[model samples]
Target: MTAHLPVLQVVIPLMAAAVCAALRPARVAWAFAVLVSWTVFVIAVLLLREVLAGGTISYEIGGWAAPWGIEYRIDVVNAFVLLIVSTVGAVVLPYAGDSVEREIRRDQIPLFYTAFLLCLTGLLGITITGDVFNVFVFLEISSLSTYTLVAMGRERGALTAAFRYLVMGSVGATFIVIGIGLLYSVTGTLNMVDLGLRLSELTATRTVPVAFAFLTVGISLKLALFPLHLWLPNAYAYAPSAATAFIAATATKVAVYMLLRFFFTVFGATFSFDTMQLGFVLLPLALVAIFSMSLVAIFQVNVKRMLAYSSLAQIGYITLGISIGTVTGLTAGILHLFNHAMMKAALFMALGCVIYRVGSIRIEAFHGLGKRMPLTMAAFVVAGLSLVGVPLTVGFISKWYLILAVLEQGWWPVAALVLFTSLMALVYIWRVVEAAYFHPSPTDEVAAAVREAPLSLLIPTWILVVVNVYFGVDATLTVEVAGRAAEALLGVPR
Candidate 1:
């Protein structure tokens, strides 16, 4: 049982998701999802501990030998990713009951939970598996389920958002499959570890470069890396609040993990950065995304769409860290990955609470909300502060490290630009803050009817809120894990 924990981490959720569809009441299905998600989070915690105390844990499916049979590998880097995904699932599912009930039809709710579970399973599978093709397989599983979840939104536009995402996602999947097939044609094995070993000797091969190019574009599409991020804002704005919270916090982060895995673990940094000078390519894109997306966010009237755009800009921060391509830089990239998850999950759920009462997430709906829904608005403000890199918040910690990384590289202008963009974040956040606190409600009925969200929603949301502040002040855990994760990917000795 202990030896098989790696496989159990993924299998339990997959099996539970299948059963969730048949559950009688939607609440029961949600409860089942909550249970399985928390259990997986516990498993992730344990896996991270084991990897830290010992070393990488590898499990061959059905006890077959590696390089010939399927393998699930766990190491510092992916263990950290697994922990982030499962923890977000656990936090988001408990909040789903109220949010989903408000946003989805009663009849469709059970299937919604099933789809959430499937998405969770796919994300976990993508993080834990060692095969390149397995990554694509799980990527499709998560992508297909995500489309279903998005389409379940109450708004008619949800269907359109789902359709657009489906088209873009299919294109991404095709490119990834072609890339994987090309790699196999050259190296004759599908295991990522085996491919990495074989491809080192073939670094200059034309086939390797083409495969790398395809994989970069495919994975970039999945990560919503700038210009490719058109599908994200709508999927987030119109989807059921629970789906937005989960997808916003986890999906792109996992795609970024796929990029890290391929660039560092599979291709080797030398070929990726030194020979190809991928930094020159990625750095400009990251800078443009950071500025352009944030600029777009400030003009949005819908708060959810504003944050959706904000998410794209935040992704640029993560990519910029990666483009720097140093130990401190990678550590900062990975750190922001986890920190942004905490911030967005908290902020979106706060918005969900607002939606629960006001039935909308538009700027107009937020009028006088600070007086009506004190706790939810407060949570939003704190998380919003963190998003703007204010002191003693998770956002600041990420920025602090990110700035240090930039300065370490002697790119003073880049560091200044990072600060400038954060102030832009403040402007957008302040728009909602001012509307909620200073403006009067248009109708007396809204003020009378709106109240704090139910305790079920508030409690789970504040758990993340507490984590944001706690991790910010005492960042021992995230820093330690992110450092080791970076070391592992960079092949540095612990």
Candidate 2:
């Protein structure tokens, strides 16, 4: 059982998703999904413990050996990613019952849960698989489910958002497949570890560099990097609240994980860093994304759309950390990977509460949120502070490390930009706070109609908010694990 933990971790949710699809009762399906999500979280925790205790664990699918057969490899880096993804999935599912019921048509509710579980299964599979082809297969599985989930939005425009995301996601997947084909043509293998080994032996090849370029661009689109991120705001803003909370918190983060796996694990440090100097490219784009997206967010009238743009800017921070390309830098990148997920999930879930009572997520609806829905808006404040990178929040820890990472490289200008953009974050976050706390509530039926969101939504929202603060004050766990993951990927024991 212990030996099969790697495959079991993914297979459980995947198989359960099928069962969920088979059952038609939305409530039953939701219950099953909640159980499966928590179970997956436990399995992920167990797998992480085993990996940390025993180093990397390799599980060959169906007892077939690697290089010839499919493999599921577990290491410090991926194990940590698995934990982050699973943690978000588990937290989001319990909150889904209320959010999904409110946003989705009754008949489609069961399918929503089914799609959600399948998406979860796909993300976990992508994180755990050691084969490059397997990554693409799972990417599509997650993506198709994502399209369905987004289309479940109550808004009529949700179909457009879903279609747009489908188009962009398809293009990204196609590029990734083309890249994999090039690598296979050069190395005659599809397994990532084997491909890495073969490439190390081969000198510079036209195909290899082209493959590298292809993978980078494709992953950039998937991770919603900068200009490629146009599809994300719509995908998230128009999705069902539950879907938005889950996807915003997990999907792009997993894509970032895929990028890290390819750059650090598949390409190796010399090729990705020294020869190609990917950081030089990522640095400028990351800076632009940080500032440009932050400015765009400040102007948005819709609160959900505002945070959607903010998520893109946060991704910029993650990429900035990666662009620094040092042990400290990678650690910051990975730490923010988890930190951003926590804070954003909390924020979106808080929005989920507002959308519950009132259908609109516009700024005007929140004019008196602090007074009416005190608990939910308070949760939003804590999470918003975290988003602003305020001290005593998870966002602050991530930025603290990013600053150290930039300063370590003597890039004072970039460091200054980071601090400046963070202040921009405060500006956008404050916009909501002002509307919610300072402005007067509408004096008509609108204010009379809106009430406090149910505990079902508020509890999950606060859980993440509390964790955001708790983890900020005690960075021992997240920092230590992220440091080890970074050290493993960089091959430098720090």
Decoy 2 TM-score against native: 0.99
**What overall lDDT, based on C-alpha atoms, would model 1 receive against the true structure?**
0.93
- Cα deviation in Å at residue 126, candidate 2? 0.6
What is the lDDT of every predicted structure here? 0.93, 0.93
Candidate achieving the largest lDDT: 1
Supply candidate 1's per-residue lDDT for 332.
Answer: 94
Which ranges in model 1 have alpha carbons more than 4 Å from their true place? none
Q: Any idea what lDDT model 2 has? A: 0.93
In candidate 1, what are the lDDT values of residues 1-494, reduced to their tens digit? 78889999999999999999999788899999999999999999999999989999999988888888889999999999999999999999999998899899999999999999999999999999999999998999999999999999899999999999999999998999999999999999988899899999884678888999999999999999988998999999989988999999999999999999999988998889998788998999999999999999999999999999999999999999999999999999999999999999999999999989999888988999999899999999999999999988889999999999999999999999999999999999999999999998767765688888999999989999999999989998899899898888888885
lDDT of 2 by residue, 6-90 (tens): 9988899989988998776788899999999999999999999998888998999998899899999999889998998899999
* TM-score, one value per model: 0.99, 0.99
